[model samples]
Target: MFFNHWYKLVGMEALNLLESFIQSAETGSFSAAARRLGLTPAAVSKNVARLERHLGLRLFHRSTRRLTLTTGGEQFFTQVSDPYSALRDAFAGAAQDAGKPAGVLKVSMALAFGREYLVPLLGEFLALYPGIVPDWHFENRPTDLIRDGFDAAIGGGIELTEGVVARELAHTHVVAVASPAYMKGRPLPRHPSDLAAFDGIVRRSGATGRLRAWTLRNQVGEQAAAGHRARLIFDDPEAMAHAAMHGLGIALLPMPHAAPRLESGALMRLLPGWYADNGPISLYYPSRTLLPPRTRVFVEFVVDAFRTKGLARRFDGR
Candidate 1:
């Protein structure tokens, strides 16, 4: 029994060494693996070296700039990557069964949506799950949920990838809005085509570097237009809203972003019946068979919050 126990201990150490090597290979550097694994660079390198010795194969081509995996290493990585990920997730799920949600919950979200809808609820979420730390980034651009190590992300129109799933948090609608001051003497747009006559506040896509066109639909049908006479252009939704509020021009904005200003009488919805269907705002995460408790609970919390506040339908302009 003592010999068996010793053998098992050695096997476990070998697994750790393999794990370190895998991290190094995946991150392309021992230093990056060390940061991820909370180990020193020298320690990670030592572990990888030990792994290479045990296998009797050089695993990486080390250079001043970066580490590249050897042919043998690449083959081994392909075999182990999926199983390693599954094992780690299983262990994490088991750890999370301790009855209280804990650890870091990293989230990426759109800035305007987070500020208007998500930020205010975080105080209550922390109050409820004090053990969970919220590590959140609010940006306008899409993020790689897995590569970036995010627990989850919230955004609209996120392209679904293999091994990732999205839960619909709410549907978002877009509307044309302008400050009442800006339209004080200007004739209200009687039709979608009339928007061409006004100065427009446009939003450019950060990822594509293209100006987003305004697409509106009503009982009649869909009408698409690009604002060529842009009075102001911004990549951020908040900045566009502010510019519209300052009477810069007519801005096509998301309902949630414009809702507050509209309520305060700073901005008025143009062609109220005509609006754009952007898509659902979704919470995206890896589709693990057993989700971590922190991620599961946060997803539940956000869904409940939107339901309780009647935001899901309201955001859709219902």
Candidate 2:
């Protein structure tokens, strides 16, 4: 009975050695597999040798030229590697969940969107998932997602780019708004060109100012006419919104930002018959098959939030 117990212990040690040997073979280097298993190269090599001795088969044909797995080793690796990999993934996932979801999640977003919409939303997201800590960057210029090491990004005018997956979180339309005070006696713009006659306030990169060339579509003409250069320019939509409220001029801004004022009748829409292009506000991330859990969770959250907020309504009729 003591010998039987001894044999069982031996068998378990042999199994451990076998697992180590398989990992070394699959990696094709003792040092590489050692790094993966958190063991020394000598230890991995020793276990692989013991495994080969027990099995009575050559596992690797070691040469100065290369570390080549023998035919038997290759067959074993092909059959077992997939299951072993799956097991490792499962274990890692379990470990991550055992504690808090621990990892740095980098995000890139538009300055205005980040400040106005996401700043508050992010606080809620963090409160809900205490394990996640977000490192967010906001910029006005176009960004390279991969070069910046961002786990994900949110922005307007999402271009089709390779190596990334993009999903539209919401639809946003550009509308011209002028203060009720400005429009009191002046005729509302019946056409796109009519905007040029009024002073226009613009927003870009958090600064409010005047802009040049406002693109407007003329339904009757069946074409778009680019408005003349702006005499006044500024950054920050809220500033522009406020300016329009104070009767500064006509401002083109996103629907959500302008919606409240429109509803309140503080601002009136220009060129109501000819609509501006309502594009997507999108969330994008790398297109790797195995997405990190945090990225997946955030994307799902944003999708659900937009749907719940009726984000699609702005572009429905357009």
Highest lDDT model number: 1
For TM-score, the strongest prediction is 1
What C-alpha lDDT do the candidate models reach, one value each?
0.81, 0.69
Clashes of each: 0, 12
lDDT for model 1, please. 0.81
Tell me the spans in candidate 1 whose CA falls farther than 4 Å from its real position. 1-19, 27-47, 50-57, 63-66, 78-83, 96-98, 220-228
Residue 150's C-alpha lDDT in candidate 1?
A: 75
TM-score of each: 0.83, 0.61
TM-score of 1: 0.83
Tens digits of lDDT, candidate 2, 230-268? 544666666678888888788887776777678788888
Mark the regions of model 2 whose C-alpha exceeds 4 Å error after superposition.
1-100, 158-161, 202-229, 235-239, 263-266, 314-317
What lDDT tens digits, residue by residue, belong to model 1 across residues 129-175? 88888988888776777555578999887778777899998888888
